[model samples]
Target chain A: MKAEFAHYKKEELMRMLTIMQTIRTFEEKAGMMYGLRKIGGFCHLYTGQEAVAAGAISSLDLSKDYVVTAYRDHGHALACGMDPKKAMAELFGKVTGCSHGKGGSMHLFDVEHHFFGGNGIVGAQIPVAAGVAFAQQYQGSDGVTLCFFGDGAFHQGAVHETFNLGKIWDLPIVFIIENNQWGMGTNWKKVSAVDDFSVTAGAYGMKGSSCNGLDVLDVRATIEKAVAEARLGRPSLVEARTYRYKGHSMSDPQKYRTREEIDEYRKRDAIQSFRSRLSEEKILSEEEWSALTQRINTQIEEAVAFAEESPEPALSELYTDIYA
Target chain B: MAEMTYREALNRALDEEMARDDRVFLIGEEVGEYDGAYKVSRGLLSKYGPKRVRDTPISELGFTGLGVGAAIAGLRPVVEWMTHNFALLALDQVVNNAAKLRQMSGGQLSVPIVFRGPNGPAEFLAAQHSQALGSYWMHVPGLKVVAPATPADAYGLLKSAIRNDNPVVMLEAELMYAWKGEVSEQEFLVPIGKARIAREGVDVTLITYSKPIRVVEEAADRLAEKGVQAEVIDLRSLRPLDEETIVNSVRKTGRCVVVDEAWPLASPGATIAHLVDSRCFDVLDAPVELVSGEDVPMPYNHTLELAAQPSVEKVIAAVAKVLYREDV
Candidate 1:
């Protein structure tokens, strides 16, 4: 862990911790808001899957690189530097939200951040990500696209189709599968033919690998190499074996899993483990940890307040975005 | 003006748009290298190179979604399906993503993409291959559906679709691809949502578009022989419906017969019939009649296939009924 931090500057490592903590806090608040019926529509909390986004997104150049992900995307958007206020407001379905309240929770877009969107349709964003990469290559840009999807999206026909095109065209895109073990309520193993999702990447003529999604360092290091390869007009797939601490959505009863299984994954919580690792390396002191926590709490509170105070979209807005 | 085939007009539109906009590119199955599945995109690969004229795998969902993304990212993509039948596989991306992206993104993104291909029955092409999908697309809100009947409209409308800011679905008539008509060499554009009065008269109105326009014209010719001057209104754009032109024609003629190649139920003809009934009710002397394809899966047998779709005789009969000429 110390060796992983050795390559990164103290400030950069602190930023990573800040991003991960922010994502965790933000998701927790969003879950609470959904429970209060403040955030309508689908609310997919990315509480336990913070490392996958924090690790991978931190490696790319946000100015030029693009990102598109599935519905469980609050963590990814925050990781891509979307303002928590705007994201929370979006979940609240306010005019100030990133998508101007037209897209409730499943679709959050910030073109300024080069974050394409958070598509609600399962596996729909896969080929779109490939197109983004294709555009990068067409324009002769070195920019890469990071396409994120859940393990469930691996079964979609578009995934294989995109994989083939991405590899054949050598498009600058890294296909990231955040294998959070479960697709909605059903475990992925029951639905997917292959136990290993990365292995399927080989059939598409691309290199495949997996990373410990629990370790932010592992995700960052593994994705850094993949992003580098993609920048050189090569496409690759990296599966991050992670888990979601909550149900698939706000409405999910989560009857598929037991408490003990949840407990097991929580014991190796990405944020907690990373904090402990930093403490052992003397990179963060107890006082510094408390201060970071305080800062993150304030940010989350401010974001919630902003969302609460934001206005609902006007009726005229219904027709504005229907066309260009 | 030059006399060119409908295929040449479409090809010219693709060529001109590709030349006019650096961001515009073509992609689909056999669009490149193979010229086109129907040779509609002939010589484009050589003129624009492989980068602009892309040959895709038989992955309709893949490339269609890719085109949607590229459109959102500021590139105008022209994605040609081998035929509209094959486009059904990619309908999810087209209807859900491309159509809804702009509104879903709150106008942060606009999918300026054109999906063009031959649609409707072509000779003996059977059920799977033969389908008139204009009404299917017109049912979707965020889509602009265009079915050009002639070479000029094909050239003009295809150019407009590529330049439009929204997602446009251009459904071409497969049988009419080789039909030659005069098209202007000078740059021109036919605005969407506006219908053209192909042949004007006052006895009865023949409202139709795409391949069925020919049927209506033939019906008009025969109606002329019987001393009935029928007005012909070609509805180039389906979704917008061009209700004003349709209503005005119905007002003048006091009768209408909508001829569509699509099936009868929930078809574009039904939509027009409903519109004419509601808006032009006072002006109409008789109820609007719709001559649509039979409500059955297109048969493989040539005779059944011909019977399944609208014919010249059917349109003439429908017109005769609307005009109360029972002895025709």
Candidate 2:
């Protein structure tokens, strides 16, 4: 891990930081758009969990590798190089959106970039992710897939089925659990019997590990190693211990956790900590840091403007894409 | 052309398609070394080897999603459910993910997969094991449902289903597997959403599909003996439903009877009866008659089960009602 971290030059590290900031800014704006009634229908923002997507995606080769995740997907989508305007336009239900506006917030997809989707159903993506890996194995590609889900998805029967399928087939995949502390309003502790995933790893007969998802460096290092092993036909399960700053969705009252707890997690905010760490290491100047922040803010603003100007899908589009 | 049973026709289709395209593969429980639950995939294991002829664990929800994923990733997967009774367990993957992926992804992904298995009643496999669940698949817009009656259709539709870009649910009948028919060795496709008139007549239209098509044909034959010509319309494709053929036949006959081996309420037969009542009402000489499986769970006793399901007598009785024949 030290060797891997040492090899990441200032240029590479800056790019990861840029992606994390872009996701944070993009999702914050999406939240605001939802509030203003510009977006509708079950919007789940990826506000605080940017590092897991950023670091994990940065470690994969998007040209061949694949990614799939649950509904909190704007972060994963942006990190996979999706144009923010297209993602925002999708949320706005515009024709220019990536899914042509039919699939709003929870169903984002870009097969060209190999981002499988924003699957809304909890734990459903696991078997689909395994299948994507099956195709990779069937086609004899060295591609490894990264599948993301929340702590809530652990209770689904589908995930358990996927665990068995993936292990038996020895498909090249990484099952990532983004332990963002809560599944909707319920705490993972109450619903889940086994919090430590090493036990799950043993039960499923797959290699497993955990990482500090708050640190982008750790996320990348852990995922990168797992991916390398996956390419050799050794599948794995990696849990990224993280948090979500926003409520589950804009509609959630979030009475389950305290503001103090959110503030406590915010102290270890992935973006702020990485920004400060880069400055102290003489990798990023304060002027450059503020300039990057200003630039990303402007980008998010433009994305919103794009959504505002984009056309709503025509009446005929409703009939199209229902088949083929 | 060759004489083959329904199961052999299905096996031949799989063998030929897998030979034609490298993307086509068979994956289901007992599809490999165990042959197949119904012997439909008997020799495919030796033909395509383990990579293509895969036997999955009894994880319908898991493997079905995997098949959808594989299809989305540009592989054609023929996933046999052994029996659609077990497919109930995997409905979430089929309804939520496979059927909706293309539309929800806004056409970026196409799930080119086939979920084929025996449906409806057979032997004494009552209640849960013998449901004609094709209506559920047809109820969804994104799916194309194919219910083949003959070996020729079993061969052709299965081949075409493998090539279709959208998801296809093939409703096969357990009792029909041993029914022999002439199938052409030279490949052909019985295009989805088309109906073939099994027996053309002008007196009355008998609309039916899979399993019950045989009984309907027998009823038509008996009607022919009685000097009353009856049209037997075999609806091979259930979803895009051969409405043109159905309406056209009803118009010609001026009377129609729908025979479906499924529960009556909102069933395919009722749907066809409504279509006839709506599309050919002006041309109709009599009210539409529906001969559907009794609105009850399938009973275990053979006699009770026959009473519960569609039979030749029920089809004839419905035909009689449509004809206004009071045994004069």
Candidate 3:
């Protein structure tokens, strides 16, 4: 861990920790709000999968690169520099929300930051990501697209089709599979023929690799290399073995897994592991850690307050935006 | 005016649009090396090169979604689906993403794309290959649907579709591709959401579009021989339907008959009938009648295929019924 930290500056490492902590805190607050009937529609949390987003996003050139993901995208949005207030407001279905309240939880878009969107359908964003990469290549820009999907989307036909397009055109894109063990209630083993999703990349004649998603350092290093390869006109697939701490959505009864299994994954919690590593390396002190936690808590509380006070979208808004 | 076939007119439109704008490009199966499956994209590869005239594998969902993504990223992409039948595999992108992006993003993004290809029944192609998909696309809110019945309309409507700032689905008739008509050589564009009055009369209004317009024209000629002067209205654009033209024509004629090659149930023809009944009920002297393709998958047998689709005879019968001239 110390050797890996050598490649990153002290401030960069601290920023990564802050992003992970922010995502964890944000998801916790979102879940509580949903229970209170404040946030409606589908709300998929990114509690345990923070390391993957935080690491891969941190490796990109945020000014030009694009990021697109599936519905479990609150973490990806925040890591890509989306305002926490806008995201929370979007979930609250307010006029000030990122999608102007038209798209509730399943869709969050910020064109200024080049965050394409958080699509609702399974594996639907895969081809769109390829298109974004195609545009980048067409415009003669070196910017790459980070396309994130779940282990469940691995079986979808669109994913394989997109892989072929990316390989044949040599589009600049990194397909990141956040394997959170379960696709809602179904396990990957029951749904997929292969044990590793990245292994399927070989069918498209592209490079494939896997890493520990819980280890932010490992994720960042693997993605950094992949991004470089993509910039050189090559596409690659990376499978990040990870887990999810909460149910798939707010209403999920979670009948498929047991308390023992949840407890086992919690033992390797990403935030705890990173916090301990920072503390042991003397990079962050006890007092500094407490201050950081307090700051994040205040920021989240302010976002909730903003969402609570924002107005509902006007009735006329329904007719507008239907056509450009 | 210059004489050209429907296929030539479409190719000219693509060539003109590609020459007009650098952002506009074509992507689809066989759009490049093979020219086109139906030769609608002939000579585009050599003219624009591979970057602009992209040939894709048989991955409809993948390439279609990619077009949507590219559109959102600030490029105008013209995606050819081979035919509307193959487009079913990519309906998720067209319906969920392309149609809903602007509204979902709250005007922050727009997908200026055109999905064009041959549609409706053609020759012996049955079932999956021969389907009229105008109603399917018109049902989607954010999309604009257009079908041209002549070479002039094909060239004008396609040019407009490529320049429009929204997602447009242009359904071309495979059976009418070789049909020729006089089209103006001067640059022009046919505005979307408008209908054309093909013929003038006073007794009955024959409402139709695309390939069915030809059938209705023949039916109108037959009605003329029977001493019934029939007016003909061509609905070039299905969505944003030209209710004004349809209603006005029906009010003048006092009788209406809609001819469509689509299925009878929950189809575009059904919607038009309902609109006429609701909006021009008092003005109509006779109940509206419809002539539609049989409600079944197109059959391979030539005889069954002929019976499954709406024909000139069917249109004439429907017109006679609407005019209360069953004795004819």
Error of 1 at A156 (Å): 0.6
Q: How far is candidate 2 from the true structure (C-alpha RMSD, Å)?
A: 1.3
List ranges where model 3 is wrong by over 4 Å: none
> Fnat per model, in the order given?
0.75, 0.74, 0.76
TM-score of model 2 (CA atoms):
0.98
At residue B116, candidate 3 shows an lDDT of: 90
lDDT of 2 by residue, B1-328 (tens): 8899999999988998999999999999999999999899998898899999988999999999999888888799999998998999889889989988888788899999999999999979979998988788989888999999999999999988999998999999889999999998787998999999998899999999999988888887887888989888999999899899998898898999888988988888888889999999999998999988899999899999989988888878877887788661
Model 1: CA > 4 A from native: none
Instruction: Evaluate residue A184 in candidate 3 and report its C-alpha lDDT on the 0 to 100 scale.
Output: 93
Sequence-dependent TM-score of model 1? 0.99
lDDT of 3 by residue, B1-328 (tens): 9999999999999999999999999999999999998899999999999999999999999999999999998899999989999999999999999999888777888999999998899989989999998888999999999988999999999999999999999989788999999999998999999999999999988899899888889888887888989999999999889999999999998999998999999899999999999999999988999899999999999999999988888888887787677855
Tens-digit lDDT track of model 1 for A266-303: 99999999999999988999999899999999999999
Interface RMSD measured for model 1: 0.8
Clashes of 2: 0
Candidate 2's displacement at residue A78, Å, is 0.5
Interface RMSD of each: 0.8, 0.7, 0.7
